[model samples]
Target chain A: MPTDTADPRYDYALRPPRLPQPVDESLASAPIDLDVRLEMYRKLHLLRQWSKRAHDLFLQNLVKGTTHLSLGQEAVAAAFSSAMRPDDYTFATYRGHAHSLSRGMDPGEALAELLGRKNGVLGGKGGSMHLTDVTRGMMGSYAIIGAHLCIANGAAWSAQMRGTGQVAVCFFGDGTTNIGAFHEALNMAKIWNLPVVFVCENNLYMEYTPIDLVTAVPRPAADRAPAYGLEPIVVDGNDPDAVYLVAREAIERARRGEGPSLIEAQTYRHGGHSRADPGKYRPQSEVEAWKARDPIPMYHDRLLKLGTPEATLTGIERQVAEVVDAATEFAKNGPEPGLEDLLVNVWADGGAEWRN
Target chain B: MAELSYREAVAYGIAQEMRRDPRLVMLGEDIAAAGGVFKTTVGLLEEFGPDRVRDTPISEQAIIGAAMGAAMTGIPVIAELMFSDFIAVTWDMIANEIAKTRYMTNGQVTLPLVIRTANGGGVRFGAQHSQSVENWCMMIPGLKVVAPATPTDVVGLMAASVRDPDPVIFFEHKALMATSEEIPDGEIVDTLGTARIRREGTDLTIAALAAMVPRALEAAEMLAADGISAEVIDVRSLVPLDTRTILQSVAKTGRFYTVEENPRVLGWGAELVSIVSHEAFWDLDGPCVRITTPHIPLPAASSLEDLAIPSVQKIYETVKRTIGGAP
Candidate 1:
């Protein structure tokens, strides 16, 4: 066993040392295409704008219930979604709008859910925290910090047992590292060598407390993975291209049955923890410094430098704007779930007895 | 019919289920290699191999949580929590997740999981290892709680539990694990909610569960010797209790006595008495009688523990008084 002192770079005090630039250099070196980069940039921008709209609606009392906004962590979801196959399973934490959008869930349904409209993904029963679309392989999102880790582990175990090459990804924040469920799920996943990618969107603050104060071992949360016999990778979460390349590699490794990997994406949340927080715990200078590394603008600049026409990007933005607007309108008009719907799924009616 | 011990019946049922369904698996600590702490799962690992009969780490939460996850994804898992007392550590996953998943998910998911754990306090395993929580599980709406007293009942109820679509918590009395009885071959017990009439009489009705069933039967025989005909009724399923059988028996006898190996207050005996009082209040000639372990936790010394639990003499005296035999 290698001791902590053996690797001086594995520091607990300072910020995590960034992985070598372009962790997947071969994939990054592939032929540059203008249209693909423009499309990616537009999708990331749409998520940011849509989150802002939802936040405003929440402030105006148009949306009811709690909503965890992922304003700054858009790139992690966008990159991972871009690398995933349509059939693969994905589970997320309470801040799940980006995950839902990335997995191709209707923006209209997403908006309606955020606005507490009847036509939401869960028929308005599960608000932002509980949005799900099984058809799109979005297994569901949970409010419990690390509870979904077990679910994802179970799903991956199921897929392996059934001989399906499909992989499952569990998305959680740095706060989840402190939970016992997280440790149990990770150990089981490692022992069984299940196909799971644990994506830790380390936004540094667990609600109001900073990660340094909460975690005894102050390091990129991923570095703790080796204790469970897993190789950990730290990536620049602010850069979409970097996140995409690393996520693709991790996904491929899991699909190949190499077991689970921990990818700690060092990112920041631009908004408060939820609709109720003003994010007063964070320093103004730190917020501005992170904003300068905003993934959408960086990817937009890279695409333009690669000869992607501005008109094409503008056209994609217009399409995203229309979809978001329509979803918002649809949610406003969607019917509320009736009281009868509540008791409908309580039991499975078997021929003689209820069976699953 | 063959003579079988209570533990053998449990093992036989599990072995039969493992042979019947390829997906039925058993998991627990030392269950595979050591044949279980009580030897209830003897020779299973050798018969089914490590995959089906798995040995787990000493994590009660993981054992139950993994079984829950497996149950959700098309597997019928029989997870053993070494002692029923340890269930408190994993109650969140067991009660909240496994028990409530079906109701919470609106029936989209069914947890076909059987949590088998040993309960009761006669062996003097002290306070931590010896507590009967069947009453606690009985309060949950979606769960089925069963405590079998005899070998035949153990085999029959276990088979029924494994086949049932919903989650079942099978509580086996550690003390009764050694008792032997005749179990009929190919005898399939139907209607888990129905109570069995272990002894028939006209003077008074004695209702008991698990280890208390034999004690109730012995008390009835003693009563019979004293000219008091006490009918012993084995209340197999606690949650979906056979209230009809109990009420019918009470109606005929005009008196009822409930015995349990649990604490007197808020125990299964209290629940049985409550049911009879509510349904057969007019039929009762005397107040419903209950013989249960004292409210205090089971003591470490065997002598004190014996006094704390209900015995045959206690049941006989309780029954005699219920039938107006003496003060």
Candidate 2:
């Protein structure tokens, strides 16, 4: 059961165009400043624990509506977001809580939105699936899979039109690449040379089903990128540095108006599609193997191997925990929106635009 | 003070807006190099350059979805669909994504964009290519629906649609594109929920939309010959409907009649009838009437289509019958 190394007996989803592994050493040193790398590790660490706490809240029936957490997929969210600038907009999918956090939406506001609190981002109108902080360039979260791909391309087009040189990053699942919107959006992005980065969270499974069953293409989905005239970059998603390196390159390409790139981050999710179901379909051995490569513990061990002092590591851990604890309190204590806010911001001058 | 065809007016309206606002751009299949199948966007690409007027692949969902994104990012876009029937294919983007984004985000986002598609079935484009289901768009919240009857209304309402803070679906009729009229050159009437009184009368109110507006005018002339004075009101914008004008006209005429190309059951006219009953039931001298096509899928044959689609003759008879039956 000890998954310290890749067991030849177990399948690591090995196929042609094989993606790199989490333990790939060459991919680990992503050229990030030591302090910033450690800080990103801190954020990934908080996301790892925050997802667990959120799942616990869901179990207690405290969280409203359905919830999808990126428990084992923190590295992709953290690294890609770290590579992004503040003005760069990002469009995320339903399992986008970590994506929002990485974009600087306060954990408290995100949690409050999930809990339907008035003080939450978007005044609780957009729950976990539709989280948005437009000012910080988190355009919005889409519950519909593959729906935001074109929207991301549109945002990229906006920047290109304004000559802002800003990039638009879209975070979707492996399943999304099959949808018509994905193909349409990618084709348009490439045809127009749009400044967008499409990062597919290739988490092996699309909900309860293995992606192979639902899609004609193989895992990581980026193999089809060439057909759309876009270069595909497959990386070890569980390794933050690997994800960071490729994401930064693609984002820079976008910023320079070199068109779009597809990064198929071969990561895994440790939880169900949402909070209600346990991911019983994944093989026990495969789950344990991926669990062994869990981004938080894996990165922490890497940091330790780099000879960070034990006290410094503990201090970083304590800081992340305090922030998470404070976020939990803030979300729990946030006020509920009043009746008057039912239709605010819907129109210019607030004089009933659409008539509901 | 120059006269223009509906097609010319459409092109001019968009050109004026693009010149006025650098943020305004347009995209669709063949809209760029080809100017568009209807030629409404003829000179736009040449005028604004390729960056502003883009021609996209045959992907309706992507076109609308990209426009929503551009609109959110402060770039207002004019997305064109070659035919209105394709809305059925792209309704998910229009209904689920674009329509719900604003309200769902608690107004954190505003989609200042327009979806310009040629609607109605008079051109024998068959079932797949022709439709007037503005009613389908009518049901969705957070969307404004506008169908302009003439060159003037087309240019004016389109300008309004481009400037509106929310998403607007601009439904242009294929049959009316070649129709010419003296539209005030470069006039941008940026208003919604306002109806235009085409011709005044006293006996009954004939509320028509898009292609039906011209037919209704013809019907009014035919009715006037028979001493059945009919006041014609072009129900220009469907959503945020011009209820005040329609109701006031109906109150004066004592009868109401609607004509549209869509199917009769649960059609756009049904919504108008409901609004009239609720708001002006007491003013009505008789039951409201609607002259709409049948529920059957539109046949390809021009002869067969003529049997189903509403015409001036149908509107005249429907108005005469409604008023004749009334006290």
Candidate 3:
């Protein structure tokens, strides 16, 4: 099961074996209505299809900027979005299309943003790496590796001081764990017992280098929670139900003033780091191996086995395709921002003297 | 009218503002229990409690960052950095986050954040503690930089700064903290971008900031004895500079002398000269003069520090030379 070589077979065997059976029997006992589960699955599928189309558009030069496609990281975003309240603040890294889309951003606006059109959520000012819609509680997606952690912490601290029940969630890659701001933010959040959730999507690779080479710790990224005086949870990121159950508990824990939790979702990116990378550094077999545990197919099979009809699944796929198609078309016809917009919003009316 | 020190005036202004607005809070190292290293925040914690008056860890970055967070959430935060030199530690938050957030957010958000720090060289605090860095904040947009010279000006300017919709770097001269002046009671000074004529004359116009305002007035009195009429103007704010008043004075007098405690080269004095030269070049009878510190750090010895910063004698000589009275 060693992932030391470029061979596909060894990498396939290296992936953790599938769970012996469904581990969510206790969670299932609560009896979530089938309609809710189906809706969540449909949304998750839409994010996946939208990201896949983004990857394709990036390769075909239809999209102007580089994209951090979350091909194999859909369930975590879907589950976290489903479990959190609308008013709760969320910040994510550059690989944040799925996160933004799941948090109620209009798919047309999201696609327009990725396409770098004037109709983007940031009015084309923030492209793929910096999509922000504060109105929707999506604080922003930062390009600076770990800077958003402090921003999220500040937001959470403000929320705590204001006596707001809203919690802040920050999403980052495993690479962010090596940064100073990450440690500083975690220490502050712990000391203040601020309502925040640090979700690390451990996709095993930070850009081209694997996590093992970059990270000092052997366990999942969240395992360092003991040092921060917080409980850590590791879940099968590819399993939607597992992600949903753990995210629910974490969100509730934060909402109840119990401080923060570090949830490390053991996942993978089925594509390259960005549109420019073909992922040649990763062995073909490793890529193929993760493909078997692809969250989309896994969730599709689980839904069918759990009494979802084939016609219903087909209908969801068709709906997702239409949504993505319409969004792409909307972006294709979106207007470009005027030159005057560049000077707009630089300062308040009275503060314009500084600009001169 | 009651006589109050500049430091006392700052404290009273903060106290009055805090009393007026419950959302106003203060944070800094040694600002709570120790009442700040300079005692400017004495009795604030007792009056306002820990939540409103906080003593933060020695980390300047954290102090400024926390203030930024509080300000972003609708709280007006008055953060003290102890000394202006220590502002470098939190420059990233000040320059990048606090100063830029309002503009970057497209004016949808306003950062009513005030960072009060002491600067100047007469206290013999040496190179590290006595540098005047107001020009640094002046270079940044979306920030209002103010340097108040008098006790009344400090009270009024501080209140205006607290109410400003943008981030403000309020510089108080360490030497002037103990200087006393008669301040008006029960009235608030609201105009921040306007300059005040401390002394009126026709021979030369002297523009000064912070501690130099008194030195300019002293020089004006000396110049008046020699039949060299000198007008003194206190530039209370730098960013929203009252260029109109300065140009008008320069045009009428035909001679300008800019004074500051900072090093001579590229200082605010140079900037003022440039502004006056550009705006009133036709009215200038002689080259614009500037009285400023030498291009070196303030030394530790009191005598050496006195030599480093511009003094009343130095300002008088500059004014005399500008008015053709140097012989």
Candidate 4:
């Protein structure tokens, strides 16, 4: 599907993100051009800005129900988004705002979805927790903890059966390892040798509790990978370069029919789990420590160290701000869905009636 | 036309569809190589090869979720949940994900898939294995529920479910697995939301599903001997319920009885009765009664299980007692 033909900015074909080449298998030796680095910076800026804005919308009582914001974990989404093929599939959890946007979901439509507007990605049907745009291969934002992990395997299976080299990247929290579906999905994916990459964004906390307190394993996802005959891959989720390197390897491995990989990306959610959580449970010292290692500034500094001009980085930030502002305006001004919408989309015929 | 056992009809139906739709895949535990625990899918693995007719682990969630995911991506799948009772383990995938994805995404994703399971009991499989849970799927909005009674309906309905642009729960009655009937030649694609009037009469209407349909038909036969004309309708589909056929049947007979193998509480019959009472209120002469298993787990003992589930005698007696008639 061709996206935003009218607007070249959103046209992926017009300006594709430069990722690690297939020939350059080693991320350590691979030279990422300044353009790709800037693109990564742009995505990071966009994700952080969009998440904070969406959080504000929730605070203003515009976004109904709860919104799970990926406030601090922009790098994982950005890195994977950059590394993934346009045809590759993404299955994300409730904390998937960044994942959806990284897949080129229109910021306006995403915000409108959060605001329950008719022009929303799902036409106000799937609220904040379920932002989906299948055209972009953003399959769904699954609210259920471990369900999509199993579902992602199916997509991978489909890709394998059809001989389509599309890799399915499934994103989940650290706590998902304990869920039955998680184990089931991993085992099946390995046995089938499916083209899938299970990326666990270990945000330290799962909902309210710290993940380690409840989880038996030290590394929730990576530690358990050995049981499923997969390598225990750990990446710095807060570092875009680090995640991008790991994501490229796993994605390539899956696409090459090397089966599935479980990567536990260590990261932190800047805000509470959702709009309802104030996150008072965390010690102030721990909170400050994670906040200091915030991804956006870290990436910006990395680009500067790599000889990218300060003006170029600030220019991307400016562009990101404009996009976010426009999206917010569009969402705020978007119309609510008509009452008739309630009856449609329940079936393929676009009607909810079960019987005559 | 050739006669096929209900179990054979299952394999035939799947084979017929798998041949037609290249994208169609089947997944379940012990389905392939082992020919399914019930042997419903005996030849699928040999015919389609391992790529399509692969066996899954005992992960019900993985099987159903994989089906939903495959369906979402244009590969229509037919997932088997060995027994209907195992639905409890994968309820999150079926009820929340598969049933709601199309709606939640505003029709962005249409899961053209089928989750076929061996349902109900008569062979003493005990409580867990012997359950008629079609009512569970019927209540879910996005699912199209069907329980085919005969071998012919199994072949026909399986075709419909495979071709339909929605998720279908195809419930094959465990007891009816051995029952054989003549299936029409060529492809047997049936409609999803239509009811089949197995027998027609004027005195009363007895609507039943899957295993209960045979009992209802038998009871109708006994009722005829007693000089009471009874119509037996095979309610194959529960979600896109054939209320039109049922209401018309009730209007003609002026009396209604639902023979169900599900427990007494919130059975599929309850919904049909509610719809019938409201729409065909003027046509009904007396209160509609439901003949179902008592709201308890089915016992392993044959005598107790036979007593628990509505029998041919029970169906015969219920109608005979309600609208009293004797030769």
**Candidate closest to the true structure, highest lDDT:** 4
Flag regions of model 1 displaced more than 4 Å.
A1-57, A60-65, A104-128, A342-344, A350-356, B187-192, B201-204, B251-257, B268-280, B283-286, B322-327
lDDT of 3 by residue, A18-132 (tens): 2222344444434555766786788788898888787777767878968888988888888888878888888898898888888888888888877767777766666787766
Worst lDDT 10-window in candidate 4 chain A: A16-25
- List model 1 lDDT by residue over A14-121, tens digit each: 343222223232334444344445556766977887888887788788888889988878989988887788888888988988898888888888888777555677
C-alpha DockQ of every model: 0.27, 0.57, 0.28, 0.86
* Candidate 2 per-residue C-alpha lDDT over B1-327 given as tens digits, one digit per residue, 9 for 90 to 100: 888999888998898889889889999999999999999899888889999999999998889888989999999999998988888777878888898888777778888999999898888988887788799898887778999988888888988999888889999999888889886744566688788899999998888899988899999999999998889999888777777888888889888888878887788788878888888899888888888998988888999989889978877777776676742
**Candidate 2 segments exceeding 4 Å error:** A1-22, A26-30, A351-356
Candidates sorted on DockQ, descending:
4, 2, 3, 1
The predicted structure with the larger DockQ, 2 or 3, is 2
Q: If you assessed candidate 1 against the hidden native complex, which CAPRI class would it receive?
A: acceptable
How big an interface RMSD has model 1? 4.5
**Cα-based lDDT at residue B276, candidate 3:** 81
TM-score of each: 0.86, 0.94, 0.86, 0.95
| Alpha-carbon deviation at B77 in model 3, angstroms | 2.8
TM-score of 3: 0.86
Candidate 2: how many backbone clashes? 0
Window of ten residues with lowest summed lDDT in model 1 chain B: B99-108
Clashing pairs in 3: A8-A285
Better DockQ candidate (3, 4): 4
The B-chain TM-score of model 2 reads 0.97
What's model 2's TM-score? 0.94
